[model samples]
Every structure is written in structure tokens, then in C-alpha cells.
Target: MSDTPSPLSRSFTEELWGGIASIFEAILAHPFIRGLTDGTLPEEAFRFYVIQDALYLRDYARALALAAAKAPQEQAIAMFCHHAAGAIEVERQLHESFFRDFGLTEQQVRATPVAPTNLAYTSYLLRVAYAEPFHELVGAVLPCYWIYQEVGTRLATRGSPNPLYRRWIETYGGEEFGRVVREVLQLTDRIAEALTPAQRAAAARHFVTTSRYEWMFWEMGWRMERWPV
Candidate 1:
């Protein structure tokens, strides 16, 4: 296989991305991401994020499995299934490494309560997975894939002084993750070609909403957000 990065589709999926240009810029400028670049973010905040992400990935994998089940084409089904398995693998390998570095056991991570934003984010995804059409589900999940790759690629340019943070950056910034995101983008374009105008609008709405949620997620980690109650 060629090692060159795949170009992202310039079709309807491109329009969806263009519509959110401002949101994407804001996400890149988010303090949590900036901190990742500078290595100034606190270990406590990182720990909270790691724990919450572990929680998020559990649901995210489920959502991907649902996507696989609902997929209209055999190729799409296989793709989603592969992604679902990849999600679980990331949780196991990446999080476990962080857990050891942070002196956290799996039991402690399990016992830790999911932060409010983390809960809200995953809940939205699961709701889409269970109830929404496949197109909308794909829209909802795209930001997590796309934004992380963008953030990681950008940060990997400067690189982090913190080894742990560098490792995190490498995961998303690597060519492997870029290839996966590009595949999803291509799938999104394929699905979009057949969408009704109304369906396109609804899918766009889901995409924007989840993109906003992606921003909130970083803030949640930065603040180490907790339940108000």
C-alpha cells in the first residue's frame, strides 16, 4: 500500500466541514488542546480526561457496532465492525498505558463516575445509534474522528514535552488514524449522494451539534467538570 495520506473527499462531506469552519477553528484554539501542545495541563486534569474517555469509548464502540448493524451495504457493515473493534482496542491499549503511568488500576477507572459532559456526549451518541438513521449516526460520530486527527496532526508538528501527551498525539496524528478518518469521510460522501435535501439538512444538524459537543468535551476535561448536584 502507498504510504501517502489519502485526500479527504471534496463532495458533500466537504460542504459539511466547510459549514463548520469556525467551529473547527475554535476547537483547535480550545485551552485543553493548547495545553496539550504546550504540556502545561495538569496531571489531575489529564487523569480525569483519561477516566472519562475510558467511559466514552465503551459507549462509542457500542454506537459503532450499531452502525455496523444498521449499515445498508456489506462493505459499510464490515467497515463499521472493524472500527468498533478498533475502538475497543484503543481503550484497552492506550488507556491501560495511561493507567499505569498515572498509577490507576482498572477497578479505580471503573469506579470513577463519568463526568457530566462525558455522560451527555455519550448519551447523545447512543441515542443517535439506537434511534436515528444510519446517515445521522455517521454524522454524529464524525467530529470525534475528524477533530482529533486535526488536533493531533497540528500538535504533532510542535510535539509535546510531556511523553504521555506526545504518545496521545502520536496515536491520532499517525497515518493509520488518518487513513481511518479518510475512510469514514469517503463513506459519508457516498451516503450523502443519495440523501434527500431534508435528510441532508438533518444530518448536517447532527454533525454541527456533535461538533459543538466535541468542543465542550475539551472544556470538560480542562475544568475537570463535575455534576452540579
Candidate 2:
């Protein structure tokens, strides 16, 4: 790990951190997440949601691998890719189990229309992977890493009887997942610190924008609704 704080961390004002924390809190407190904890969601439907998410991760992992090749922070990017691959494995297991339980397959997941939030988030990632500055790419991806850790850890504490919830929570709440979150946070913080004030402001905007979309992603999944008209 780099001993130096990430630019984002160094530049982070109390206000900025508080704003980001607020977004995270909103996402966790979203009704969908609450429903998930209480087991009000139908298992098959929830499993379907997981299937779509797993497919998204599959593409996300590939995008990261490609981005790693051109990353200015080559060493850090490589490490991120390794960590991302591990996340992919977790998703794959979830996908397989969902398939077994719901009699759905990867092909069906591919054929399904993506939720609006799913499309928005994935598009942002691909665009960042292809066009954004190396540090900015890390900034864009950090929320996904951080939010999963936060949500997963919280759900794990809730002790749901649902086996799937147990599995999902265990995967994301584990040490390996925690390590990934730390790595992304450190990378984004480094990016923030290196920026000038104007750049830092821009970075903060990007981070918050992406985070808002993340909340929408979960909301869309939770509601299983198409994007708002």
C-alpha cells in the first residue's frame, strides 16, 4: 500500500466527506434495502436482480482490465484489477446460485433489458475506463466499492435468516472485500490530494454525481421498476 494519502483524502474537507457520507446513508436507508433485510422481496425476483448485477460486474471487470493497460498509475491499476477480479468471482458464485434456484441462466440475464440505473452506472464506468484520466477512473469506481462494503457490513449485522442474504453479506463483509474498499478509497484520496483547488472541486462533483447514480441504482433494483419516464 502507498504510504502517501490519496489526493482525495488530503483534499477532502469536512463538508465534502459529510456530503458523501450523506449519500451513502441515503442509499443504505433506501426502502429497497430495508425490504431486503426484512425479507419482503420475493426470492426469485431478488435472485433475478442479482443475476442482472452479476452480468454488469462481468462487463465491469473486463473494462477495468482494459483500463489497467493504459493507466498512468500502472502499479495501482494492476492491484485494482486483481481486487476487481476477486469481486467478479463473488458475483459469479451469486449468479450460479441464483441460476440453480430460479432456473434462470446467463443467457437470460443477457437478454433482459437493463434497469435504467444499471445502464447509467455501467455506461459511466465504460466511459471513464476509456476516456477519463487514470486517477479519475479510480474516483468514479470508488463508490461502488465503498457502498457495497458499507451496505454488506450493515446487513451482516442484521442476521437475516435468508440463506442468500447470509451468502451475500458474508461475501461482501469479509476481509477480502474490506481490503478492496480500503484500496479504492486510498487511491481516490490520493487523486484528490494531487489536484489543485479547481480540480479538487471538479473531482468532488464527479464523486457525488456518481454516488447519486449509485443510490438510484439500488433504488431501481429494489423497486424492480424501469427508469422513470
Candidate 3:
């Protein structure tokens, strides 16, 4: 209910983000994330992550596109549509580069079953975009952008010696990505100013749920997760 207020006031998104800081801390301290900084994670794990991310981004873009369709404002639609395109572009370039360099075959990536965690994560976001109120849908989607940028910034400063891992870190930590996140945040704050307390609380719940998924996403890679067929 309470936001991270300045001496004067608190924005709903700011409060919601601050409320989730502990969860964010847990993510920052996770061994999976730590590995990206230390260059100690296994190659299979990294490859699993990259491939899974490519799969995830395709659906993630769809969710953003859905959000654009439902946005109340033209600005929201434009921003979300641009982001939806950017998501796929990032997926194509980033994952393809890693796939080529790391010897990941298209068949291998296509045949790889989506991890349970990943399936659940994307399904939830899609559901939110389809069914949740505008404010709450925005909340569910924001964590993906916000968390990656935060994690990327932290990891970028002390990058792993591994070239592949460094590439991942640098992409998220880069200024262009940061600019996108900032734009989203500004949009979030503007929408939030008009939201009711109950709506804000609901949005906060969506934000927290997605933030947890972000943590699980890293762990999903660390485990090199697969269905036990």
C-alpha cells in the first residue's frame, strides 16, 4: 500500500518496485546469476539458457503485442508495439549469435522442450495481458524489463571472462536497453497516477509474481531443466 516516497510523495510503480526489492536481492544473490559474473557456470547451462531465452522471447513479444492491442492510450500502444518488435529483434540477433558461436543447432533448439518453469512463466504473462486490467497487465510485464536491466547493470560492471557470458551481460546492461526500461517506467508512472488504491495493490501483486518468475528463470538455466520424460 505504501510506496517508496520522497519527502513529498510516492509513485505507485516506485512503491511497487521498492516493495519487491527484497525479492530482487534474492535474485541478485542467486548462484545462477552469480555465475554470470564469475565465468564459472557450465557451458551446457549457458547454452540451455540462450536457447530457452530465444523461445521465451518469441512469446514475450506476443504478450507485448497483446498489451499494445489492449492499451487505453495511443502512447501505450505505440510504446508496447515498438517494444514487441524490439523483443523479437533482440531474440533473433542475440540468440542466433550465441547459437552460431556455441554450436547450437536449429533442430536442437526447436526440439528442446520448453522447460516447465519457462512454460509457466510465459503462460502467466500471456494470461495477464489477455485478462488483467490495463494497469495490472502493465505491472505483470514490467518486471521482465526492469529486472534484466538491473541484473545486467550489476553484472556488466564485473563481467565474466567468458566471452559469451559477457555478451549476455553487456546487452542487458547497455544504454539502449536502459533507455527502453526508463521509457516503460515513465509510462508506468503516468498511468499509475490515475489508478485507485485497490488497482495499485493488484498491480503490485502482478509485479511481484513476475519478479519471482524472473528469479526462477535464472534457476531454470542453472538446472539445465528438462521434462523427466
Candidate 4:
């Protein structure tokens, strides 16, 4: 873990702006997401993915809520809880609309085994939330917020033909999500500034590992691969 700020964080806000810009560009350039935007994804498979996303969000909310109780500051924890509440709202809407459209039931989603990527991501988060310092946990969780906003914003720009895609994109790309990410990053930077060299290195390793697992989760979902140890 490097104690120094990431090249991207040396200028903090400017780096975040540039980072998000690059991220959105990359997402829009993704072939699968492009296919999704153009309504070329197989209907059944797309539906399956949507169902999975909704289920994942539910679990994500639970994980965040659990972390919130242990966050260092009352305001920070409260914000996390509020974010979880917002996620539940989106989950409900996705359930009522997209799930029904796809003929997916809550029971079916509940019965689905955690994909390897999903397990890796979730387990890492839970471990950070439970055992790491509050600042480190924030660093660990920031990727989730960043990734979704990145994907959602790019997907929105592509103007998906499916109403559901549009809804999902807008929900995440909107001002609310932006605000959350901004707040989290602000808190993370404050903590990062205070870390000892050894602690900073550890925190960076945790963040990078968590990010790699996030990518792994998507790969597993898309490839339908079994967990690979």
C-alpha cells in the first residue's frame, strides 16, 4: 500500500472528475453494454441479468447498512443508511416492474447461489466493514459507488431502447448518486491524508483487491463461470 495519494488523487477533485470521465468512456465502449443499449442482448439473458442485478442490490444494501452502524461518524453512518433506503426503493421498483416483466420471482433469486465474483466482492466488503478501521472500510466501499456511477452514466448516454435499462441508468447516474460518491470520496481522502505509511499501503491493497473482485463478479456473471477458488 502506498502512503502517497494515488496519481488520480494527488489533485483530488480534479482527478475524480477525470477518473469518472474516463470510466464512463470505457463503459460506453464495452461491447456488452453497447449491445444492451441497442436492444440487441438476447431478451431472456438480459432479463436474467436484470433480475440478478436487483438481487445483488438487495444484498448490497444489507451489507452497507451493516457497515453504517460501525462507521466512525454519526453523519457518515446516517448517510450510508439513507443510501441503503434509496436502494431499497429502487429494488422495489425493479421488482415490481422488471422482475415481473421477466417472470422472475423473489424466491427464485433468493435460491440462486452466490456467483464467485459476487461472493468475493461481498465477503471482502463484509470483512472490511467488520474488522477494518472505519476509514479503511470507506475506502473499500468507495469502489462500489464509483463503479455503478461510472457504468450508469455511460449506459444513460447510449440511450437504451429498453425502458428498464433507461430506468436503471437514470437511477444511478442522477444527482443523488453523484452526491453520495462525492461525500464518500471526501471522507476517504480525509482519512487517507492521516494514514501512516504502513497503514496506507494496507488500505490501498484492500481497495485494489476489492476492485479486482468487482470486475471478477461481472466476468463470472457474464461467462456463467463457476467460482474458481
Tens digits of per-residue lDDT for model 1, 86-156: 99896579999999999999999999999888889999999999999999999999988998898889988
Error of 2 at 146 (Å): 0.3
C-alpha lDDT values of all predictions: 0.90, 0.71, 0.90, 0.67
What is the lDDT for 97 in model 2? 83
For 1-229, candidate 4 gives per-residue lDDT tens digits of 8688677447333443443454445445554566667876556555656655666677678767876887777887888898788777855785667777778777886787766566667777777777877666665776678877767776777777877667767877788778878787777677666777677666666666655555554545456655467
List candidate 3 segments past 4 Å from native: 1-8
Lowest summed lDDT over 10 consecutive residues: which window, candidate 3? 4-13
Q: Which pairs of residues clash in candidate 4, taking residues 3 or more apart in a chain or in different chains?
A: 1-201, 117-217
Query: Could you tell me the TM-score of candidate 4?
Result: 0.79
Encode model 2's per-residue lDDT on 1-229: one tens digit a residue: 8798665454354335566888888977887677667776567557657866876786578666765775667767687678668657866876788677778776887788877778777887888778866656665666677778878889878856677767777877778789877776666666566777776666566667778887887666767756467
Order of models, best TM-score first: 3, 1, 2, 4
Name the lDDT value of residue 131 in candidate 4.
81
* Residue pairs whose backbone atoms clash in candidate 3: none
Query: What is the C-alpha local distance difference test score of candidate 2?
Result: 0.71
Tell me each candidate's TM-score: 0.94, 0.84, 0.94, 0.79
Question: Which ranking of candidates, highest lDDT first?
Answer: 1, 3, 2, 4
In the order shown, the candidates' Cα RMSDs to the true structure are 5.0, 4.8, 2.8, 4.9
The Cα error of candidate 2 at residue 53, in Å, is 0.5
Q: List model 3 lDDT by residue over 157-229, tens digit each.
A: 8989899889989999999999999999999999988988899889999999999999999899999888877
